[model samples]
Target: MRERQPCVYILASGRHGTLYIGVTSDLLARLVQHREGLLKGFTSRYGVIRLAWFEMADTMAAAITREKQLKKWNRDWKCRLIERCNPEWDDLAISLGLPPLRTIEGTR
Candidate 1:
């Protein structure tokens, strides 16, 4: 089985753009699914595919709880959280070595 590292992540449409908060045990795989629009919903509909930020957790339960907490945060708070680590709000997937997505239906 693949190594699993629980995490809380933030996705953005662009710098200072729409945002999405989620939790997963496998960040890379989950990132591919989001970029590919495979796990349809708010992310796909709003084109929130940029990997803005992420924080590791010791367990899925901890990740989920973190995700929930982030979701409840105001937009300003969320933006500050992203800026704390990603001043440029870059698509961190590229740093993780994932090739840039070739857009489809405005996503990527």
Candidate 2:
């Protein structure tokens, strides 16, 4: 069986665009859903599907806590956090072992 890792992740519409912070035990599945527009809500509505940043945690509780903390952070702080790990604001899914999402009609 595959082990689930707790993680806090951020999704973006584009560089410096709308952002969404979330915690998940299955990062790959979650990202897949977001990328496919399966889990409808803020992410789908805003086209915030890029995996901009993420941090793994020892436990789900810790991941959730970190996600909440990041959510409270101001936009500039969040941007800095993402840039610190992803200077180019690239989709990190490929680095994390997921398939790259192809851009369609200039949309991600």
Indicate which candidate wins on TM-score: 2
| Model 2 agreement with the true structure over 1-108: per-residue lDDT tens digits | 135899999999988999999999999899989988999899999989999998999999999899889989999999999999899899999887888778778865
For each candidate, what is the lDDT?
0.90, 0.90
* C-alpha positional error of residue 66 in candidate 2 after TM-score superposition, expressed in Å: 0.6
Candidate 2 RMSD to the correct structure: 2.0
1-108, model 1: which lDDT tens digit per residue?
Answer: 235899999999988999999998999999999988999899999988899999999888999999999999999999999999899987898988799867667744
**Root mean square deviation (Cα) for candidate 1:** 2.9
Name the 10 consecutive residues with the lowest summed lDDT in model 1: 99-108
